[model samples]
Target: MNFLYLLVVLLPIAFGVGWWASRRAVAQRSGVQVSELSSDYFRGLNYLLNEEQDKAIEVFLRLAEYNHDTVETHLALGNLFRRRGEVDRAIRVHQHLVSRSGLSDAMKTIALLELGEDYVRAGLLDRAESLFSDLVAMKAHAPSALRHLIAIYQHERDWHKAIEHARRLEAMTGEDQAPTIAQFYCELADRSRQHGARAEAREYLQRAFACQPACVRAFMLTGQLEAEDGHHAASVDAYEAAIEADSAFLPGILPPLLASYARSHQMDRAEKFLRSLLDRYHGVSPVLALTRLYRQRDGERAAIDFLTAQLRQRPSVRGLMALIDATMDKVEGEAHENFLILRDLTTKLLEGQAMYRCSRCGFGAKAHHWQCPSCKSWSTIRPIHGVASE
Candidate 1:
């Protein structure tokens, strides 16, 4: 019945109303005033429980006007307004709270924070940036302010400011920001590389690796930079390092790494690396890669045998398709036609399959993303390992 929403959003307001009523009963000599305020509070709570937010806002605003010290109630109302996507009303409530002459510094800071968030939700980044920057400078709610500032910088694609504020947040909170900082550097590197700034891109990648030694994206960018300069051997090394950093990224790494191996005539290294992965990584990617490698180096019979052995262990639709493709030529007539049908069925089985998913939000995607599109988190979307996926 959506009572959960009432508990999360209106519970605090209800408690605050009860507390205010009790304080009034103690301080006021008039029982009539106490009964009126209590009635108003209950009426607002009833509206909230019924999911009539507009009527609830009206009753709560009246209560705020009646009791000057109901700061918590006002804050809760502003938050509810923002949650309901009524940003203008949220801004007004917070602005009124912030402008009150006798408001405490702490309460004012809280209201300002809310106002800044409302500004962000309304796409007034400049106002949000100014307010949050002022909060940081005043050392009031500095950590939260810094985080909001970083988010603003990220939205603006200002990596330098994002990194600066991330470091500041790290210093303030004593939590490691190296991994996220590395991602910011990687973003800068990707931009530089796309603009034909190879040296600048390389430098940024070095900084990314310096922050997080096992950053897979940094290793991938390193491999791309080296490969562009015709340094296939170096590119191969970087791509292999990427896999070692995170074996879950094998599907993304193996294609480019294999190309580098072939360009540098490092088939022997490719075979050795892929074979080594078979024990540590349980995904079908390494097995499929090794099967193709075997097919190229040995013969179709050897490839078929290897794929057949691996399919029993992994049992993947992709592996089955590869096996059918490899062995289709070896059969003729009815057998070949049947194999073609099997291959078509297997292909259909894999159609529209989500190859990657976000661990944070469970968002599924057909392609890989460095950040989760749903959660907006870095490095959370990973390849899904299953019978029909990587």
Candidate 2:
């Protein structure tokens, strides 16, 4: 179905190119050349439809060589080469176009942009950066060049440059870029925090908040910085704010938030918060956290009762595992062995299951990430909500 659809889409473009080639031949008063060019064009289209890309490329390359003034033909050939992962061939085609003396300024800039993309595909980042930078400076295709520059900076982990170009893109396009800009700030903050530059990290966090007042990552980082300083109360405040900013991050936020509550001797507050979450959030993390709190503060009986009620409300494999763990000690011999088997089965069921997934791309991961590894989109990987997950 897809192959047929591709053929249908390409047929019109093929006819258009053939018509253009025929008209050009007519203008040159070459009757035989017109038939020859149309014949070759259809042959190339036939090869393309049959998935013989190498032969198609050869035919198209011949057509492009025969008509030096066919700018669109060369561009199409370069794009086809790039799509086929023949970056070297794509570069050569675009470079030939760029080096042509009679090429218009607009065509030259487009060719340069295509060459820059070819460099990116070939892992020639320095060359790509230089080409894109020149395009941005020339302001010929500034927005597209800025976007490519931002992508390159991100790949290179140059957060400052990424932020700068993103801002430039926003100014040129009149679009809201604060959310993306905040993520860039968060990246810088994380780097500073890893290097133990606490003050610098804080500064970046502030900038992130300035860009996006309710940035969830910035709040999480603030919680981490406060926790590192042994300011448990402050950490609790920041973490609670993070949850409020984005409840989808509960699995990642709740563990550290619970620790901060314990360190600050705020079990009552933790219980209240977890209870509130049970109403608003449907995930099992809060239930498990509350059960643990009850087990520690109240008794095993209270914890079991609470867990049983919650399990009846929301069925969960993890909740069942916790319930089994609580009651396993009461059983003996054959029953104890059965419980052990059940626990092992539950553990295996949970094992290797992706706990988080990207909202943008549906990329699954066992662990959470601020940016999705597949899509490279920030804050899109959220905890998976289900019976087996949070």
Candidate 3:
């Protein structure tokens, strides 16, 4: 029911109808039927434009009955029904197209594809899967079919099948699905880790690294596994590698990484690494981590000085909050009350802000996701770099 999409579909049909009307008019020298058909077509379009979908559908259905041989009209009607969330109507229209006696094999496959999509919209995934599998076997629209099958497998959490089909798609299309394939491996690794199958998890992580050498999620998982095994130094290495792999994920990576650095008694190394990040990565997270480190080692005054200097450069609300908290202890009476109010306001501001967003679809999230929940694209959701966020 997208207005533009409706126009695009109906305009072609109108042109065809007008052409047919001209032919009949020349042969019979009668304009009555042609005038009625044109009026009906325009009336249906008007009804659709006015959001009178029921009336529009009725008129289009009559048109379909009159032009039974026009396969494109049926296809467009089915697509329109699907887009309007009338999945049952869409399925019936596509089924009728597939069952028609004189339909070409090419047209039949297109109808089958449309029917499969309608099934998906109706949450009949098993039926959709069967239809798409048949299309793949026939090698008619195999790429599209494989993509849908991969989506279905991902929805069902069937990572093995998803990975297999992804590989097949890559080989078929030469699109280099390595990054997506790596994410699937990471998913498998996470599942194995949750089930306490450490070796299996490690194997999956290895495969993930093989697929994409600089995969940040794989490196992060490796760090987590090493940390769980009490190998703090190795965990530190993996975590640092993760940051180096993708600095955009620094906000998510910093906390656990800092903990590992502390447990391994690498505060000096931590300071050096954080300082290095400041040179290239302009984020409040690294600045805040450095502030805490300085407060623990060099004293409050030194921490405040460093944070104050960094804030002048970054201008982060989080940085401002840190500065307020650091100075609150030095204030008294009305000054202390004012500082408390400021802190609460900053906390509220931060609370409502989206910390992560999908680069592909612009879907905002408070937490990081490796795959976009909206577009289902892998490695597209990353930390939002702004004064209120990263």
Query: Which pairs of residues collide in candidate 3?
Result: none
For model 3, residues 18-54, the per-residue Cα lDDT tens digits are 9987886787657886788677878887787787878
Q: Which candidate is the best by TM-score?
A: 2
Clashing pairs in 1: none
Distance from true position, residue 14, model 2, in Å?
A: 6.0
- The sequence of per-residue lDDT tens digits that candidate 2 reaches over residues 230-298 is 999999999999999989988889999999999999999999999999999998999999999999989
Ranking by TM-score: 2, 3, 1
Q: What are the candidates' C-alpha RMSDs?
A: 3.0, 2.2, 3.1
Q: Supply the TM-score for candidate 2.
A: 0.94
Q: Local distance difference test, per candidate?
A: 0.92, 0.92, 0.92
Task: Give lDDT for model 3.
Answer: 0.92
Candidate 2 wrong stretches, greater than 4 Å: 1-15, 27-29, 46-52
